[model samples]
Target: MNIKKTVEKIPGGMMLAPLFLGAVLHTFWPGTGKYFGSFTNGMITGVVPILAVWLFCMGASIKISATGTVLKKSGTLVATKIATAWVCAFVFAQLLPEGGMVKTGFFAGLSVLAIVAAMD
Candidate 1:
């Protein structure tokens, strides 16, 4: 299959595809990373280095003059995410019982902590 072309066809597909695959892998076979003794284990478990490289690449790709623009855009995105999360938590708090949890129903076992964590 032409992975590059396929990924390019969808917006943000390049990043999303790998993330989806990783989530599936973790969901179905959580031990796969530890089961692999060498490079596979490192590739799965050693995310910090990979994240550092990705962050470095992202930062490196931006022009020096666009630093302010990047900062402003990222700041706005972060603020929006926090605001949205807060609003969601507040709404959930109102929907949930006084203990801030759903005890019985389709949403059983859900709590404010879970909502906040999912939002974050």
Candidate 2:
């Protein structure tokens, strides 16, 4: 199946895919990630390697002259996203009893990840 094409059909699939995979793994086999956390088989070996490579590729792809402009624009958008998420998190934190799932409603139960992922 064309997973990329399928995800692309849904809005914000880039972010949603990882989230969905996480949720499925957490729900069905909670210990799977930890079990895979080994030198040969890894899960939380973490995103550092991927991030480092991505950063290097991005740096190589961009023109030095455009770096400032790129940073300025992306920084503004990131700042705005952070501010908006902060407000939402603050509101939820004040309203909710604790980081538990709400059986009664959409956000009766919430987690720090849910709060932050929205911003991400």
Candidate topping TM-score? 1
Which runs in model 2 stand beyond 4 Å of their true positions? 1-51, 98-109
Per-residue lDDT of model 2, residues 84-115, tens digit only: 88888777767666543454667554665587
Give one digit per residue, the lDDT tens place, for model 1 in 1-120. 998799878898866776677778878998998898766666566777556766887788899999999889999999999999999999999988989988899999999889999998
Backbone atom clashes (below 3 Å) for every candidate = 0, 4
What lDDT does the true structure give each of the candidates?
A: 0.84, 0.69
How does candidate 1 fare on TM-score? 0.60
- TM-score per prediction, in order, is 0.60, 0.46
Candidate 1 lDDT trough over 10 residues, lowest sum = 41-50
For model 1, the stretches where C-alpha displacement exceeds 4 angstroms are 1-44
On the 0 to 100 scale, the lDDT of residue 4 in model 2 is: 74
